[model samples]
Target: MGSAKWIACVSLVCLLGVLSRGAAAENDFGDFSLSRSEWSSEYMSLDSGHFLDRKLLQVQPSSQTQLLAVRGDRRDPLDNFRKYRGGYDVTNKHYWASVVYTGIYGFAIGVAWLLLGALITLGACFKLCCCRRPKVAERRSRAYYWIPRILAFLLSLFAIGVIITMFVRNSQLHDRAFKVRDSIAASANDATSTVRNVSNTLSNVDTTVSKYNIEGLNSSTLSSTVRNLNQQADSIDNTVDNNVNTINKLINGIEITLIVLLSIALFLVVMGLLSALMGWRTIYFLIILLGWLIAALTWILFGIFFAANNVTSDTCQAFSEYLATPSNTTLDELLPCVDLATAASASNVVRQGVNNIVAQAERSLTQIEQTSAALGRPVTLPTVCDPIGPAPAFEYNSNCPNGTVTLGGLPGVVAPFVCAAEPVTQACLGAGQFVSRTNDTQIRDLSSAGQSLVTIIPTVTRLTNCSIVYNTFEDIVNNQCPPTKRALRNIWIPLLLLSIALTLLSLDWIFANHRNKKERYASGRDPEAYNNVPK
Candidate 1:
């Protein structure tokens, strides 16, 4: 019994190996054959019965093959030329059949790819959302260890999606080629039938004219009859010529259309073939999706970390102390926040407040000095106008000479003046005015840009992560995923659900096998039934 079990396992392993090797071989050759550009290259199985007769017919010669001998300006070269025509080319028909066969092969590959993609996607979803082992299982693997596997699986899915898309595109081209071939064939048949009918009608007319003794009638009447006959013959000749020209035009159109279609199809196949040569896994699509999910998770974690570390009250206290103390003045030096103008034009409420505080302190000090001066009554102090009334407030300007200052004028005072060692030039004054206006606008513009960037950055980052979702190609390749998606939430969701169901089914099958084994051991005395059971 142990030996038989071992043999069964070995056989299963061998079968799997064979299947894998077979698929690899097919893929390698299929790509090469599809990519080849030889004129004789064909996709149909030549060994098959259906193609044998077609091959024979293609090689055989027909009466219309001689029409090429008398080729002229396609003018009225021969009267009966149209009545016995054949197809223009045999090679074109064969090329089309090859295209059809190639398409069938590609379609088969696509079906396999779709199944593989679903399997891989399901595996990834299971790794993400489900436990490695069942909840009731005794042993469990750590989730972190499985992360790499999940990423690898997803990447494999992505590559697979690309391969499938390529295969589908190739198949579509092949189908177009087949359609063109069929159209050409149908047109040829129509032309042939029309020509045969005309030939038969003409032959009958010749026989009737011969049978009748019209030349033995009255001289005048005979001459009239002959003239009418001559006119009718000319008309018949013209009609036959017109019909033949129309058939030739139809043939030319079909050939041109087929050639164009075949050329495009050939290009697509070649491109797909070259792309597949690189050693790449087909399941890399799932990896891309997994990558996005990882990014989203990373952001969620980062946001949590940032929130947890924030100390609002402490931050406020630190900010206030930092502003007040000169000991810790690095931030002040770095930022260099002067009392920036807040109003429209040159008004700055903040600068005015600072000036008020400074002026009040100075006046008190000055009064104390004057009191001492009065109490001492020493040498008479020269009366001096106070130079400490209000420190001049300057409006911010981009083009102002360094250290140029502006006085905050009262309502009646003649506007404001720029103060410098040298009187301000007209050019300088104009520059300063332009600078002030631009500075004000720039500050506002910078603030707006900053706010916009802050708002949009996180959203843009999230959208970048969401882009992986669009990398999906199940529907695009064969439209298999749409039905699956509509039937469920998405392709992955159904695949995940199905995987769980299959796992359960597999386990049930295993358990049933165990149960049957126990039953057979209990009744091993009946050796025939036990043997049959194993088989």
Candidate 2:
């Protein structure tokens, strides 16, 4: 009988589910009928799918037909450049085609024609027993050499374009990148500050917890544990603060370098153009100096990567040490430190103390309001946090200068403040003034509670940002620095090689002078022919 009832119940549920879904389906199609149809949009239409990822869809009214589209930032500069290079057809096909047309077809063909005519005249002289001088070969040779010089000149022009492009893209890159860096830095600062706050809160919590003796923890031993936790927090704070500055400087230096590179490219281009057009012998030597400049910038990036890696390794080790079990140590001995994992857990004693304090505050506030009522004076129960204007300035100190801010601190307010304990001096605080006084106090107290759990949030965020640790020191052996480093090497190293090559090619003019070349040919010292000329 039970089994039969169970089967009947299941069948009834299935029937109900099917009927409900059918009703829902019918409701869905209610807006569209045979004769009339209505269109209601939840999200706006996005048409630039090819260029952008997910865009913010507009919420349209009944009369509106189109939605506005939002755009995001561009991809990495190097990736854009790779596509741009292809778009401009800077490939071997074009490069070799240019070389072939200028060298093989134009210069080579014209030089051969001159040489053939010169040879024909020399042959007639020998055949008619009227020996003539060997043909003038200097001008044709110089023009032949002009082709490679022209190529060098073109390479320099391309370098200038690359420099300008890099400057523009790097500026864009910094515009986007610094925002990310600032965000990461802000998180690191907040995390570091929070850790320190927790440490200070722990000291007060331990004292409060000991007074109630809620757990079987010894006051002295608990103090020792809190001290250890605080020490670790301090170390982390120092490390994070130092590395943040280092990373900021590294990024700023890189930004400035793009401009310096642009200047250098402009200078080298002027030198190269002069070398090719006017045969400026000294100008070719400047390429050697340009090569050295490239090497210096390359090494600086490597240094930054090294520093980040070193910091990462030390942080990982310290974090692991804090998490590991102490030798023959009891759980009571390492209360806070033992629980410092990627996710840290707070003690019940701290939670109890916070509750006790909050209860005491509530009672105090009630007593004041009751006394006011008893005296027949106006009593505002549950006090409103209306700011009585900016906090009063201390007797000796000056007022806030020139401007007012709502967050952090007011200009004249003293440091080491507790919420609502001290008067605020800042102007321009509206709802926030009340928030700091009334509504947020409980939430702040809850955050201050020891029993809450928090993920070890700072390590991964700060470490992985710019791969501060891995790229700087740890991951170099494994070849895992930011791909930008490799892309930069690809650009500057080839430039250096070209600089050296062009300088070497230009060395020929140093040894063989233009004036001496014709003299040697006229004196038969050029060695093209051994036939003696009759005087």
Candidate 3:
């Protein structure tokens, strides 16, 4: 019974080990199969089904998959705007219409306010200078005399509060502007670096290919392809640089302009308040006119920011849709997709070249082995992995005969044989020369060149596909837009309040001046009764 139990336990352990290994093998195979399927699907649109095994140039599949997953459904850019605007089409037409209407409204309100204040001032001046008044006792109550004064004092305090709020909001706007500018600059710099790296890699590939002297490997086609890609990369780099620089300049200009304008507005408001307190009619009137002008300009700025917000929202929507499905969009004109056909062709050429070089090296090794055996030297060399068959040229074959020696491993394997202390003969000389020609460094360089070409495909794709730009736009929309819009609103709303307060303060100055003149005239008319009159 003890022996039977031991046998059963051994059998169970063996079975478990087999099952575990089989599961691991199954998982690895499944992963490879899935990867192969993805490569095929990605290239199917390019109509290059023959090059589906080129998995290295898969175009940032993980990012694309994540973006698609995040964007579960297509979205329209104008949806929210349409709902708010009562189903109005949110096109350039809508933007222009809003701008025009807002501008006209602001202009009309500022002009009307200025004209009303001017009329009131003229009336007060005319009554004081041109109109005749009866010399009679003032019968108005004390409450009537003090009410306007108290109201003017309260309004002036409110105006000060509004100005302080405006200052706070303006500071917030400044911070928001800098934040946006930095965000844009960071994104642009990343995109420029990516393109520049791709360009340099292509140049390196060209140089590496030119240096290769592998037998039976044709690299002319590959060199031409790399040159073409390099040109495209340079063009893209220039375009991105120009666009980003222009945007940065615009942001800086807007920032400086807003700072100057707001500072002037604040200065004018402060001066107007002092003028009111000191009862300076000329200075008060001047401040009102300047305030009207600033108010009009602020409204115009509000309209502009509104239009920009709409355009940005539209762009975000378009970008989101592009992320979901990258084809067929106007954005392609700005950020073009890499030429998959050209990339695939380059990959195929590299693979074929590597295969040919390996094959020729293997043949040379076979020749060396045969010659050594015939000469009784009998130098045993490891068999090189043959990548040239009906299967994919780039697919690694681990099941190669007699301990697979890769292109990278060829030099190490041949080194001992070449340095072996033996009789120096014609065969030995040949083997030594072969070793020099097929040195490890040379093979490694070739392999590295192929790898450089492969890796750059996805990078170029990411650049041309505008995936980085898309993510930037996403950040702008989700993270930056709301705060910016809020800051803009905060700025303009406070300006509007300040305008109203200034208007009322200007009228109070006019009324207070008239009241003082009336009192002085009454006092001069009856000097003895001036003590009884309200002073």
Candidate 4:
């Protein structure tokens, strides 16, 4: 029963191997025909398979122009229209130009605000120092006395609220940035590990081929295939390492910039508030001037982040479209499909090598049995399955011919013959040893090679199909894109709002300070004026 079970298992592995080979024969790129069930089972962790339909494997447009044509003009006229409106093709050029324009727009607004604040500060200083005050200060209403103070207090409160919200948004942006970094690192690692596993497996297969030295099998094709795969894996590994290093540096720089800019903005706001409250006219004016410059810097940063967000969105959309139909697109140029011939040839070599080993073992067993019988210690040895047929291909049929035994059952069948045979003669002893060695070593090695080949087929299939990169892109589109875009918006939108609020607060502080100073001077000029002043 144990032998029968073992036979059934080996048979199943061979059957699956043959089926995979047949599937490979059907497609130039080797079994890329992923069924819905396969996709669900194999890629459920990616969370992007559901976004794809049966058409996920369909050939995509051959070039960027073809892809753009197929997708049609998807631009939002209102949102995307600018100086480069005619060049809006949603390509990198368009989005990058949009970024430049956005930065310029933000810079222009910031500079205008800075100029306005400068003029106000200069005018107020001139009125206080260069121009003479009226001999009698005009009587002001109670509403006028309290309104500016009330407005200043309200604006200060609003600015504080905005600052707190900006901090929260910035924290979220930091979290999202780290998550993006981790996701990319993880994906690259996964691809690297998968390729490494395949390279190792190919090496093992090569080792097995050389160790066994199966007759009638050519090692050249197998060696060349293994060498090519290893080289490819090494190239891929190096590329991933370089890209990851570059991206890590970029993300680290962005994070540092975020920290520095926010810290500066916060420091400026706090100092401006302190100077205004303490009635230090010179320090307050200096703070206001610095605030204008800082506000302008924040606007420029906001523009940069906004552009990044737009480009990210555009890239995500383009990638998602490619996922829906990946073949023949420009993405193919970036990530070429696996070579079908190399994959098929490797599998065929292993299969044929296994078959050759089995056939050679059977021929040795037959000679040993005949020699044992002629030497007066006649013993029947177990038989291996005939060389696997090309037509009516090898399936799960383990039942041997009338006089032979199944490949897996050979050991069991040979076991009793060797154990029961006596070493009555040197010739009989020699025959038994040959039979034992053939059964124990060569047949065992053949089975091991078959099992190894079984594993190699699927790994080769996956590599050739480009499913690793496919799944990575799917993960980017489904898992990474939305949160990244939201995080970018959170950062830039809060920055823009904070810049505007801080600018307004500066203006309010200047006006309130000027009014207080004028009131103090007027009160000093007349006791009646001091008496008339509201408490």
Candidate 5:
């Protein structure tokens, strides 16, 4: 009995080991089953399912009697029973693991979102309290006069958008992670159960179990298949490591972008508040205008980041698929081609051939990588592709003076080369010109230091009268003209508050007028008093 206990314990230990490996494998694919639907997608969409199936799917069976064949493949009656039991156990474990991870990730994202919401709410309260003391009419004027309230509102909106985006992304990552975990656990359990039951049945009859086993192979085939599968898994592991390393670089870039954007936004908010409180209208408006201008400028940074992300993701996915089989042509062909010359001597032909293929692959990979980095990375502004009428005809370059804009060259022709972003220039040399070229309506009536903004676009007539054009350059390095300078105008909140204080001086003027008029009218009753009325 003691000997029997020892054997059973060893068997159980081995069984657990097999289950663990199986579980991990399933997790890699999330909970997504390799059903007919999945197989079809892998076949048509990926165009590389055969490679994955032969390399990774054909690993050695974990124990005697265990098999890894097509789901419905006909097998000996006893083998079928063992496979079914093993598959079920694996499925169960993976599902449980997935649930746990999903819950944890969800909680973290929820907490972050809640915190951001609370901060916004707190900011709003402060805003209301600050203005509560003034009369209703005065408060109304203060609100419209544009100061802390507008700045706060805009900042809050930006924060909200950011928070929402983060929540969505976090949720997606958590979901995918949990799915992989669950599938791995379940697959392990299933594989283990099948082996255990089969081993037990064979032992009951004192039948010796085979040392090596393959799902659909005889003894000789079993050993070779097992070796190949092991090699394939190892290769895939290496590839995964490479992909992760690249992703880390992208993650670092994203962190920097987020930090810069947040700092700029926070500083703007503080400055706007201070200006409004100080009663300096000119200064306040100037600051507010600056904030809007910065926000608009951020749109370009966002676009570049997005482009980078797309490239990286595609490259990573392709790499992941390649790793599942080292012998596969997809990865093998592309891994070695960095610097060999294609037009070299015959002695160098072998090196050149490999390098040529690798070089081609590297170029494709680089483009994808750059795109991915840009996408996964965060930016200060979200890209807004809305057609804000026609683009500006103004010529913009990095060399353009900071605050003074110039539209050089002839009127009816295309605007000079102006890129929204420096690195990626628009293709057509004279692609699109600014819509306000005709000067039918003066965009800016510039005379001396003062300038008034007028809209040339008839569709946006509302801005024609009130919008004041100030001396400011394009939103970005490129001449992607933003909504007329009103959006760019920095109505520094702090400055706006100062202006309100100055507007109060107008009240003093009204009071002085009243007193003078009263004295003059009273003096009219007596000529002597009328002469005494202060000038």
Candidate 6:
């Protein structure tokens, strides 16, 4: 005992003397930047399935042009518009509160148990020579020693409860989700009705939006006009309907994945409990301890990812906000008519054809007006539904060669329209044409030839409704984007606390095992007596 006491005094003096020397410089110089200003850039993307600027499809042309102007127009901002056409984005709802608390408790238990195990094990082994055991020691260990194990179990249960609670809370949101979905469907239906209303209204306007009703024309221009109008309306309808279907699919996929994940987790939990209950507690401890390390590493990695994507998170939030507005404000201004613009401007030939047709229609309207100049007098035209120069002529189709034919084979001039299907002779072409109509219909309208242009505004307006909902694959991206906020507060700090928990729990478990083994003799006899007597 005297020798042990002397050794302890000398060790304490040496430790104090070493610490007093202020410890060798732990860090080399230049480890940190001594700067007043710092600039950083992150390559985080808004869509996990893509990288960088490629996912921004519905870019505001105005904004892009603005950027171009800022850069002195050296770059074409339109070049940046790239569409994302991928499968459903996977989602993660970060359950921070529950995750952090559970981890904190585990870490603390590990630390406490490790300490307890080390101290008690050393004392029992008589390694601390001065601390001699009593000859008549208590036969059993104190109930207080089991507190850490009990607390660990209790805390584990609490974490499970928290997870269950989150599921419950989100289940309510699912109810809300159904309502929101129905509302969006209603909105789409209303927009469809509005387009039909515009069509019916335009039919009443004279020479402005209706057909000229020229007689016996092989290709019925009026029917074609109505067909085009209906086609535009249908595109709006189809785009929204497709978007809704995709969203539904996404939800179904998420539900399935979540179910699979939870089932696996439950299986792990059950196996762990079964092991412990069956007295293979050491194995159970190892399972839980190793499981905790893996889980901690996973969470810490995820937390780092969330922290790194600060800009992407903000952009996702901005996208959400952009979609929420119902007005024709900047949101409307920015995105409205863009689909039509993209479809229309996709080819220079198509634009030129559209221009020529518009010019011819104007000329026809003027000539007809001059011939019928008598006030309130109606004049029958010498010819109705005249060719109008076939501005939107097909450059390619059944009989026409792709890229070699344009504007119905204008030869020298650029053909404005191009057809991807059979020629207009055998097929009407495009969507309205695609909807199934005869190439040569005798049906004609009594309205002016130029009147068909009125469908543009209504078509554009209806199309904007598609953008108001889940228009693309980014819906899930926005939903799942990780926020940089609260990671340190909700994740890392709690993880640190969890490390503390783990340390404590390890000590308790280790010490308790020794206590059980040390007292496993007749009437708490010392080791020497137990070795010699009644055996």
Query: For each candidate, what TM-score against the reference?
Result: 0.17, 0.37, 0.63, 0.66, 0.24, 0.37
Best by TM-score: 4
Taking the tens digit of each residue's C-alpha lDDT, what string does model 5 give over 353-439? 122222222332243345334545321211111111111211111242343222211111112322234333334213321123222
Q: Which ten residues in a row have the lowest lDDT in candidate 6?
A: 12-21
- State the lDDT at 31 in candidate 2: 21
lDDT of 6 by residue, 352-456 (tens): 223333333334334434533432334332222222223233121123333331222221111112223444333333222221111111011111222232223
lDDT of 6: 0.33
lDDT of 1: 0.27
Q: Report, for every candidate in turn, its global Cα lDDT versus the true structure.
A: 0.27, 0.34, 0.49, 0.53, 0.27, 0.33
Error of 4 at 262 (Å): 2.6
Off by over 4 Å in 6: 1-145, 173-246, 256-279, 282-290, 297-336, 339-535
- Per-residue CA lDDT of candidate 2, range 205-231, in tens? 444334332221225534554565456
- The collision pairs in model 2 are 305-472, 306-472, 308-469, 309-469, 309-472, 309-473, 342-456, 391-424, 391-425
Model 4 residue 192 CA deviation in Å: 1.7
What overall lDDT, based on C-alpha atoms, would model 5 receive against the true structure?
0.27
What candidate 2 gets wrong by more than 4 Å, as runs, is 1-142, 172-183, 206-210, 216-222, 252-262, 282-535
Can you write out model 4's per-residue Cα lDDT over 1-535, one digit (the tens) per residue? 2211110001100010111211111211112121111111122111133322322433333332224112223343345553433222332354345444655657777778777877876897798898865444556776665665676566666666777777677777667766765665565565556556655664575555454444323344455655665666666566556555555566667667867776776776666565555656677667767767777777777777775665566556756776766544434333344443444344455445545556655665676577667756787665766434432223222244777665455556555444223323455465444344433454454455545554554454445445665676677779887887888787778778877777676677667556555444442477357556554
Each candidate's number of clashing pairs is: 20, 9, 0, 0, 65, 42
Ranking the candidates on lDDT from highest down gives 4, 3, 2, 6, 5, 1
Task: Count clashing pairs, candidate 6.
Answer: 42
Tens digits of per-residue lDDT, candidate 1, 360-468, equal: 2233224434543554522222221111122231221223233322121111111122223234355544433212333223222222322222232222221112111
Off by over 4 Å in 1: 1-144, 167-171, 203-210, 213-535
Off by over 4 Å in 3: 1-108, 111-149, 211-241, 315-318, 332-445, 455-457, 503-533
